[model samples]
Target: LGLASCKNNTETLGSPLPLNKNYFENYLNARYNEEADYDPNSPANILREVHGLNKQGKLITQVSMFANRYPSEDALKLFGANEGVGAQLPQ
Candidate 1:
């Protein structure tokens, strides 16, 4: 969401960490349309309610949550991004 969430020099506004912009847009649009039409759990619900908050530009909001969801380093680095949003940051 901001510089605070960007620890990787390779990640930035221009470089979006290889996320699907279409899914991201759909995810953002889903926030406004909450119903069976946007069920996050559905694989192909036409619209998703909440797949990965990262797809909605709110990864920062789910930073801690993702950590618990993905505790392993390799796991977190994969689907769950650290982006300096875990439990540490340079003071």
Candidate 2:
């Protein structure tokens, strides 16, 4: 199903697809593939990232220091968090 490339190259990420083909780019958008391959709502294949807890600890969150990603630093600081979400919807 896949082919290996540069076996001695440690810096490489993973095995290449094949001649003139890319599996990740082609199958990444399939919902059934992602759910069946991994699990429910894994977010591994998602591109839009709203917030994420960089640390694995129970009370830790890795919010972006920049303004656009998350602007609610106060709520995050309540638990030493790092990020939050800011979405506006029309009524």
Candidate 3:
């Protein structure tokens, strides 16, 4: 019964959205519990992170840019595949 309920909950949540500015905002909120303020648009908040926002404000980090033109789960998969294959990337 618990497993079935959890499945239904996940189904109702729908498909996951790609990593984007809004997602980053929510993540920061959850991670810091609103104690440490973070601005998703600030370079300081994004520079050291795994994701980056382009001029148009999308999570298309320097690394993921080579994988796909747009941000999506498939892009992440492609990036992972490239890493797995030991693709040489610029420093």
Computed on alpha carbons, the lDDT of every model, listed in order, comes to: 0.38, 0.33, 0.42
Quote each prediction's TM-score. Answer: 0.21, 0.15, 0.18
Which candidate order results from sorting by lDDT in descending order? 3, 1, 2
* Ordering by TM-score: 1, 3, 2
What are the runs in model 3 whose C-alpha is more than 4 Å off? 1-19, 31-91
* Best model number under TM-score: 1
In the range 1-91, model 1's lDDT, one tens digit per residue, is 5555645455343433534555446555543222222343445432333443332211222221222222344433434244544333345
lDDT (10s digit) by residue, model 2, range 1-91: 8886666545543543222123334444333211123332455423223354332212333432223322244334334121222322223
RMSD of each: 18.4, 25.6, 19.7
Which candidate's lDDT is highest? 3
Clashing residue pairs in candidate 1 (N, C-alpha, C atoms within 3 angstroms): 40-49
User: In model 2, which regions exceed 4 Å deviation?
Assistant: 1-9, 13-23, 32-91
Collision count of model 1? 1
Alpha-carbon lDDT of model 1? 0.38
lDDT score, residue 64, model 1? 15
Clashes of each: 1, 2, 0
